[model samples]
Target: MTAEPRTHRTAPVVAGLLTALVGFTSSYAVVLAGLRAVGASPEQAASGLLVVCLTQALGMLWLTARHRLPLTLAWSTPGAALLAGTGMVDGGWPAAVGAFCLVGALILGTAAWPRLGALIAAIPVPIAQAMLAGVLVSLCLEPVRAFAAHPLLVGPVVLTWLVLLRLAPRWAVPAAFAVALVVLGASAARDGGVTGALLPQLAWTTPELTWASALGIALPLFVVTMASQNVPGVAVMASYGYRVPWRETMVVTGLGTAAGAPAGGHAINLAAITAALAASPDAHPDPRRRWVAAHTAGWAYLVLALLSAALTALVSSGPDGVVETVAGLALLATLGSSLAAAAGPADGRESAVVTFVVAASGVTFLGIGAAFWALAAGLAVRWALSFRRRGTPSADAASGGAERDAEPETDAAAVPDAEPEPQTSTR
Candidate 1:
């Protein structure tokens, strides 16, 4: 009897550790990539990671404990990828930090205004999924490209990931991350003693707002976080039949983002993939007790934050391509799922494809990124098709009232979902 109680006590802690491991393995490299895109140095990037982890972890713990629901929040991995693809700006890191602050304020505004939340909810699922798939394309392809460039270094990482995916899917990413680190360390030791201290260092970057940075970096970051991360995150919770108070969650995440940005962090949002680990029945036999797992995971992230500088140092020691290779390996499963979601159904296929192509092109026009353009193009196509389906203006005018009735369900919260079976990996 005493043994049973001890097992019960230990389960949630174990679940939390698993959740944090998956969360870190899959997304930390992308976070580094994002900070680098804005010209953040290694110390600055480490600080960004530290602040983001601390803030999002606290937000997750607070929300879960308050609601008695496993509400897991995370940094927007897709938003980070968007920043990486956007490249450096005119005012550099300070300008990017300013953009980060603006994005947080925009998220906070959405929480305050029901109409704004409704508008965000009104974006069709296909376009949102397509945009996400598009954003992931470049990074997802890095493993293959990296192997081609550095077969000796990257091949082993990919091979280890593939083998573990077959034999021990849950350990696949963490194992690969470890293997890559070992190889990187060895390579560095061969060249010379690795430089850089492994202690956590906090750095702050003052915001330098610029018109070009705001329009280009800030706008795209906000859109991708909302469309790719937050929307899907809500969907994931709803899939498990959790009617999350999404607006409240948004308010807290926005506040977290605002707090972290000046410390070099980018936007934080809902966790779509890793959220399942704590929300699932697997976390605890009793559904009501699952929040304990999420809360524990939050504490674990806080612990991880203390080691952010060391983690960043390990990543910075490797060749850039090797780091990307590991990151791409970690994201493969997520990319596959996003693509599957994007391609679903017949009606939205055309719009989805257009969105994917434009976003994957990495094109920049008038200081704006392909992600914003892709979203615009997809929405335009969807609207035009809806108009065409309604026929001529007289017909459209005649059926305008009916057309309103024909609109796709815009209430994301109201969409019922069958419980999602837990995947082999949290991602």
Candidate 2:
């Protein structure tokens, strides 16, 4: 039998550009929402956003280049929101940057310590899925509410986009974004207001760091970035068949975090859903050639980061409703899949139930969110059940002493062999 040929295909510049645009656009609202929650002045928030985009782009570039894989680096959207809410209220940009540094150090520390890294890796997939779902559920709901408010505007566009996605999976998001943009522009023009005013703006602020800020802002920012963002980000790469070393990826992310933190870059980590968009077969069936597209994205990010003012102007000037609606829709598929995957198999029903409920409950304790708690609860229940089963004496063992005597030997046999120890010679 003959093996099939492995074809190499390259990602187009336009595709890379589109990927970055979608990535930035989808997360932009979260940035704004976070900034507002934290009480940042419009100027500080805008400057912070610029720093975030630039750092994210650079992190993405360095990792992708090193691994020859499409490893996307992004600012933690959730972390940003956390900082905007907590850090902003407490200390402002200084606190937030301090949080960024702390978080970066923690992530780097995890990478340096193999035991911790292994433990993180050992987290069951289902629990991770549940946490991800819980976080994204609210985000996915926004588009639905937006459509209800303006059916004539958002309804037809969303419906059309869904149909296209079903019929042409690869082109769905880009096409939908295009259609929505046109409709929004036309509507704005008809209303006698220029539609092009919603583009992003460029803003830059020098870094300011303090101890209080670092503890209040930077530490939490780091935790969310590593736990929430990078964990899933690495998963995206694994799903796409790129098995790069975690330590290297962590180091790259750490460097980016350190470089951009002082300038207001909160936390940088791998991309999960968005990176998958560029890494999957949809981007290019050929794995080897896709590196070109990822490289393109990295360079593009660098340009945007350096030219922060222009990029900020472009996004800020665009129609708010259109951008939000489109981003919400784009994330719908990812949100659903993550939730479903987290639920686990039917046989593990009770554990799965606990995982979902706790994660979705939005309960937070001791500065940690529901995601961490859900996994903990589920794991505890699973282990308890397993231990109980193991401890129970079998019915056959109760009937015969001989069978009972054999059990220990069987258990011993089942135990895995340990590696041989090195010998020290005595002269």
Candidate 3:
């Protein structure tokens, strides 16, 4: 007999908390790094981070409530890095925000147009995989660097993570984090120096709009976020059997961006890898049930962002060596699998290579980075080959043979059976 399906009735508060913690912890470093690269003051960057996190949490909550799916939203970490790096060269924060608005409009437009959406969907899977792999590479590298800096702090954390992965893969990340936290607290107590290391304090920054900033920063930021972040994010949902409306999701993301941009929130998109962690069968085979977890994360994000100062202080107080190392090791398996999947199959190998090289190359043109270029190049090659093959005739047709070369071999195997057996004498 088939087992009865389980129905989920968990509170949204839990789901929100889970969503927020997962989103913030996973991407906070990258966001702060971007802010520093772009020359934002520490206070401005901190305020911006809070704004982005809060907006993203609200957006995810709103969308998930409406769809009843475990849809998680996130700020574009890579896109932010690109903005921080390139925006400084182009114009500044104003340009970046303008570019973001433009990109949002484009994403909304694409969602509105079925044809455009289909075109975006037609991007080769290998290229997408390659891009994802490239992004995960840095995550995998972090643990090694952290360990190198403080073996005493990071070593035990890594060891604990390995033990957890061996025995309980499902709880590996959280378990590793918990272990690191314990070690850090013990170390802090032993050292007896708790003067400056405290909870983060509240900070806020108003948005500054400018034409040069829009062209230099916002446009590139938008391109990278949509191409590198949102595209793969949508794929993650589809792969996991979520039937969310792409257009509505994009519109919501746009709304989130508009709400938070002035406050230093960069582009926000759907979560790709992080969502996979919480939505996978490991979390719960039942799709409906995982919404509880996602909703929990969202609520958590709201609380954390509101208490930005406290959260920031806590993170600052932690031993970076332990936290960074643990985070890196925790994500290694995911990173490896993503890279392997992206490079799969000989037929799409070239596309995958192009995607990886372009994304990692750090090349930019027309205020667009390599992610879009890689996709465009791979698609062009794929289509050209298909068009070329369409002009060629089959061997059987060219030979004018009466028998069809395309016929199945099984037809020949059954020839003798085509004739019926003679009737029995008893008849």
**Which digits, one per residue and each the tens of the lDDT, describe model 2 over residues 231-350?**
566556666677646677677777777766665566777776567767877567677656666667777776655544433333344444554566566556756766676553443346
Candidate 1: give the clashing pairs: none
Clash totals, every prediction: 0, 28, 36
User: All predictions: root-mean-square deviation over Cα?
Assistant: 5.1, 8.9, 12.1
**TM-score for candidate 3, residues paired by index:** 0.66
Mind giving the per-residue lDDT tens digits that candidate 3 earns over 1-427? 9764343343333444555665566556557556644555555566667877787788877877787888888888656545433424344555444555565665565555534443433444455556645544544566788888888877777787678778986556666666666776676667673324234433434445455455445544554565456655756776777755666777788777776665666778878667775566655657777776666667777777765544344334566656545545644665566567566555436657776666556456664544455556665665664454446466324432432341122122111111121001011
| Top candidate, metric TM-score | 1
Where is model 3 poorest over a 10-residue stretch in terms of lDDT? 418-427
Give candidate 2 misplaced runs (Cα > 4 Å). 1-15, 18-22, 25-45, 60-99, 178-245, 262-266, 271-290, 303-322, 363-427
Best by lDDT: 1
Query: Whole-model Cα lDDT per candidate?
Result: 0.78, 0.58, 0.58
Per-residue lDDT of candidate 1, residues 273-385 (tens digit): 88889888778777788888889989999999988888788777777677777777776776787688777666547888998899889887876667778878998998887
Residue 3 CA displacement from its true place in model 1, Å: 9.3
* Per-model TM against the reference: 0.87, 0.66, 0.66
